[model samples]
Target: MELTKGANAALDAGDVEITVSWRATAGSADLGPSLDVCALRLGADGKVREDADLVFFNAPSSPDGSVRHIGRTPDGAGEVVTVDTTRQPADVASIVVTATIDVVTPHLTFGGLAVSARVADLATGAELARFTPPPLGPEKALVVVELYRRGGSWKIRAVGQGYASGLAGLATDYGVDVSADEDVSAPAAPLAPTAPAAPTAAVPAAAAASAADLPSTGDPRVDMRKRLDLRKKTVQAVLTKQGIPGRQARVALALDASGSMRALYRAGTVARVVERVAAVAATMDDDGTLEVWSYATEPVALPPLRVDFLADWIPLYVRMRKATTGQGGADATLARERAARAAGWPIPNWDAIGGQNEEPKVMALILEHYERLPSPPPTLVLVLTDGGLYRDKQIAELLRRTAKLPIFWQFVGIGRARYGILEKLDTLAGRVVDNAGFFAVDDLDAIDDETLYQRILGEFPAWLRAARAAGIPL
Candidate 1:
């Protein structure tokens, strides 16, 4: 088989022709089948250009099949032809073609089972042609082949054959030649090459020192602050871009109610946390959903407490405070022990219910509940915890599995504890960390009402920006 091209000279917008030639052996035996041939025009960057086209030809079954016409060039300067046949004939076969085209980077591609023995001018790594030959025995066969261009050569990149023997010594035979006019303009030179030299030695040191003094790169705190600021800006941009006003930003709040939550309760911080969280939730206007939950082993839905409903909940809140105070110094540990002993649960149940416990079952429940909940208006989950014990790996895996779900997790550490786990949720500092998609506030006690409000308000925008960056829909 021989492949040739028309005059290789053309403008960047000109057309070209490609031709393939082959000979079939004279015989009454079945030559099998033929395949399609495709041509791809590429830009200088090696990406697919606008000028690419494809042509297909069927190999002849009888000696008369040897004279098959593949395709034609209407107005283009060039044409590509393919001789797709399974049986190798003893006679010489040749293809001829022309095209009226200009391609900055030109390449060829073929698909089928036939073995390609040679190619020219085309880089060995380039995808120029493809073909698939029929199977040997009675079993039906299908073959897929594609060629790609490398630095200076064309190479067969992919081949799929079912019930067919692999083509042997296939790469040694193919070639390609790109003929273009010399008049085509070359790409502009890089600016840096012609630019003047930068400052040297003493001057450079001074500039470097100035840049160094401006900011440090490795500081996590500073980095976090920048990331938070950028997140807020991005969120605002998305809201504006989506034409959703700040007041109209429909927000849903889901809080964690596992046993670990009792830590915040015992620290005399749950009420304050709820107060602050509620206050933030109220700012979303009447359009927002403020469904709350107090989950222990399971999630128990709290009424959608509106700002107006806060007055009514105040009595309930007072009763809750009195109930806790009634227990005297009974903290989360004491409460867990009481619950465990009352149920005659295993001793390990106390540890499991404590802040350091891992509750895979509870987490699964939360995930299921979240899945079932009426897609709650671009919701955000605010988990107030002391960074207690939880199935980190299981939770991380679950989160990854459901990553496509649009729920933003913002953890607020409500007590004095090492929030190392929470820090992993911050994307910037935890850049390579697996769970960096979430956010956290580690020092809730140090935050004032204004700061708390700002933090809460800030979360929506930050999360919205993150979701957008991740290509998640609102």
Candidate 2:
């Protein structure tokens, strides 16, 4: 359906994609306006509650992960944003999609540019609505379209509202705290989308510092400090009780994103789990950043978790997979496998990684990550899973070989499941010292932070002492 200014269309699809397109040469400059697409997640009061509510190239995903600035269209003339309405919070009454000229690319305006926006169902690739605004004059930013809730259903409207003040004005109108000097450029040099973990290197002996000496977080974002203060306190208490209050380690988190664990992911359990684990990193990591990976058949390296954007990180990555595996079982799965090989999709392959559990592959990836570090600090790897461990021999071999290394594996079983070799990590033979621990919780969300942290760090101190005694470089 084509929509004119002020006209609206009903959105029946659960997941919809918004593509804003314009003529590549529609600007006064050679590169055109250099538009940056963004979304403002607003509360019922029609204002953003926080700065994280603005999704753009810098912060690609909203805090809850309901809305994301996916990327530019292949042609470079358009940008795409995805919205999952079912996952959005009830308080989010609307999501306003806008485009602005990159502040760095000055002297460009929307004068006489032909701009159009389309809304489509992501699953079906069918256009649900389209909007073509009238030619503009001197506007540097525009609210092209908006997805809003009405009578418990979603609807999209063609806004075509012009903002002469660029991004700061549009953001300020929606309640985002924009300062004068902030860089509001679109598509700033983007970080590697694959994973947030930087090249892991061993922390030099001279550089090792206790958790107490580390700052609240390495990221300079001050708001995150206040957000993480309480949880850091809880983690500190647990570390103190475990007799390692000041000890530091490079923290790594591995999450299970298999099909069977979909329930946990959908219920918002995974996000809470990340917060609990992130608190541990905040207190115990040398740099206070949590290196992270998500695995099923293969492990996907994710962006390292920072206390600064902790609320937004979980949803952005955790829900990266599709909502369902396949409707037709084996045949459908096989067809997708073939299609994936031919399509060469740029994003992470959700279907391949969501099919089954494969621990050794991810374990190797994590192991190689830390081993590459020159003189690494003692590493604490927290592995979260909810399924069975059928590859007993492979897992045991990997653990036995790494026993002498300054690495400890803490296998946390999330739900009731058969954990074959994990239950016997304490008894595994041929290791220089006990380098692993296993614990299970039937209800992860129900567990308090203090107890969870205590149980998680229960065996780490013992392993640290033994590793030091065995002549391993501390």
Candidate 3:
């Protein structure tokens, strides 16, 4: 690429044009022909302009080829000549041009500063096209223009401007500039050096260890199950210590009946974990008031909360888990599960749980219940499933919406699957996520009965303290 500006005393009429050219190169080696070209230009006004072209070149005989002239044309207002390559035996070497100081607008301020600018293409409507103005002060300003291409059209993207207060400033403030009536000249002598030889390839190292070496299962449900059980027991203990009967704190065990739960059956860990948590939550109170609801595509209240409702909710959990495994993939299963969980829940509309995906929908359901349920005791939502969420924006939005709510999001990652997204929600790092103080637990496969029990017991006091700080009536 070559950009040239006619030299004249007058600055305004000085026209600038750029030409881009290319050709194939030949050499002693039997290597294929190659094309050499440059997409940079320097104006007579001490300004720089560069452009990149998606050039299509023919095959070359050798890697090291000779420089050959192709064709040229006048670019900016016919001031710069650009060459085009036709039939060259060797690859085209490069395109070169001189730089010039383009335009300087003084005594003008925008957003609190004086500005001067220029552009490679004069057709642009927006000023400040190639450069930004210098800082306001008693000094001379020098601005540089650089051009390139993006998408379909050409663009002058960067600007380097400076402000100084002495003789250097005078050169910048009123120095030699490009003239208007200057004509296009023959291509200048190529000042840039020839291309160098290509580097040889290096060998790669051996592969690393596989997933078998990892410490835990990647499934989300294992983590969810352990965390839920831990949270329930902790809440019960805290209530017992406060002299508040455990029966008084109503705990609802909402399970996702979505098809994805089926994946857990194949692993065995998810079904067993769910069964244990349900049994524990059901036996928490003597009145047998533990309600189990299953959802998928829609909510189904099971072991109904009506004092008369009694059968094991575990079987239903198992059934749902078996239905989703290895069939429609995890994402599909999770979507079904989210839909069912949302349907089975009380209060909050299904829309709040989101119309798509399990995690966001579960979050929506939690927020809805928190808002609608009458000053209920600090409720613990033990969402048991694989922590596979499909929508990132929805999760962020839900977190923001529920930031003020007194709900703790405990994500239990089950199996040997990865739960990187869930780990991000853990609040131990003092990073208040989405303005919501929620934490998560991962690696359920590693927890023992004693550790699991103690962890659940530990959550009560931490949550209670958080609730107190938030002024939530317990």
Candidate 4:
């Protein structure tokens, strides 16, 4: 259905890509007048699930392949905030499309710019709707249009609502806590390993082993049934500090799989971190399942992980990392990797996942899959990195954009490489709440589980309170 300014239409839209695009006139050539498209995914109550649902240039897509903003070159014009209605998850009741005057641009408003937008089907490139509202009074951003659910049918609303205070105000209405300044803290000194633990007698790297040779579940839980009274003692002791009792949330790990992380992987440091995270899973997760993902050239999800198999996982993983090429693919070796514990050999997906770290793509892939969930859980993605983050502006924008979500991002740097960008994450501009935190540890093993858990949990409580208060679905 075609829509005029302020008109609402019952749309025949479904599972189609709705591309929102806009460009302003040149009266303000000297001043920045870029058009930014954003998608605000509403929950069942016609409200947002959390900031995670808001996808834009910063966070380009959701975890699931559902909603994504394939638009690039914000000001260059063309399609922006493309929506895949078919991929849109059920919990996301409405997809609000917005176009705002670039926030970073100074002294620019709708009144000074000539802007027009079109919503077209991506496949056909057919214009479904268009809007050219009258000159604005004082607003700097416009809720250009809304695609929502009505009577079991998707409908469209030409919202045309303007936020005089600009993106920040629109963000506030959408549950973003923009009032809070970006949270910043001095980067902690990196943890240093004292001395390598005494080595066991050297054995041929090619030796064979079997699954029976592996250890039992290290978790104190009775086979991962419940989260009550069963976490590891040290994990439980650490969590008892009580700023808040743990609540069920989706937990995920983004382990750096770059070549630089080779040493850590070989040393079994990755396995140890997994164990510590399992202890955390025993607390905050319902079924004790942890979503595991690792990134090198790009991001890839791994099978759900439990604490039991995590033992000797890295060593087994390293064993497959032969000087030869075909030696990879850990999934193929899971049976062997498991048998390799007794028989020691198969590593399938592990060989294909890591390389160069693309932090932006890493986050985009995670957010995409999360949005695909039937009901996205309040998420916590622990990113363990061995070095610096090159795409600062991109990652900074993502953290700022998703700050309203019931998700907290923690970055743990393990190597000597300076985490210069991550250290100042809290100071990035345009953020709602401090959605991300960063800390550096020179050695992964040097930090105790309690200390690791403590550092990870630090800003979590405040984020919970802020997100809930902002009306974001937790």
Order of models, best TM-score first: 2, 4, 1, 3
Q: Per-residue lDDT tens digits of candidate 1, residues 1-474?
A: 222110011111111122322222244132333323333322222223221121223321223342233353352222243332222132222121211111221221111112232222222323333222221121122223333222222233222222211111111111122334222211111010112224333334344322112233332223222333333344344445444545333344444444445545556456545544554454443222345554444444444544322322322321121234211243533453344344222222222222233434444555676678665345556655555634566656655665556665555655454555455544433221222233346556566454554555455665566666776655
Computed on alpha carbons, the lDDT of every model, listed in order, comes to 0.36, 0.75, 0.35, 0.62
Cα miss at 119, model 2 (Å)? Answer: 42
lDDT of 3 by residue, 1-474 (tens): 211111001111112233222111232231221112222223322222221211112221112221122222332211222222222122222223212222232332121232223323223323222223222222222223333222222333222222332222322222223343332211111111112224324223232121112122232222333344444555455446544434333445555544445545556555455544443454343222454544454444443332111111232233453344422445544444454344232222322221222556545655665578776555555555454555555666665555455555544444343444555554433323223222334555556544453454345456556666766566
Give one digit per residue, the lDDT tens place, for model 4 in 1-474.
545443556565554555444445556454445667788888744457877888888888877857788775444654466676766676777888877776566566665665556666677777677765444545667677778664456766665556666677677656655655532211111111112233345334354121112222332221121222233554556556745664667788887877777767656577567666776775676445577776877677655554433332333433213322211334433443444433212234655664777777878888878877766767888988887568877888788778766678888888888676798976777766777888888876777555777888777777777788777788
Model 3 ranges with Cα > 4 A deviation? 1-248, 254-261, 266-268, 279-288, 291-311, 321-357, 427-446
Per-prediction TM-score: 0.37, 0.52, 0.36, 0.48
Best by lDDT: 2
Residues 1-474, model 2: lDDT tens digits? 998655566897989999999874434444554689999889965689788889999999987788899988888888999999989887888889999987766677776467899899999999999998765666788889988776578888777767666777677667788896864432110111211223334455455333222233223222233335656877888888888886888899998877778778767687668877888887787656799898988888876775534533444455425643332233443444454334221235565675578999999999998888888999999999996889999999999999889999999999788999999887899999999999998998777666788899999999988999998787
Candidate 2 similarity to native, TM-score = 0.52
Residue 206 lDDT in candidate 1: 47
* Deviation in Å, model 1, residue 75 alpha carbon: 89
2 versus 4: better TM-score goes to: 2
Best by TM-score, which number? 2
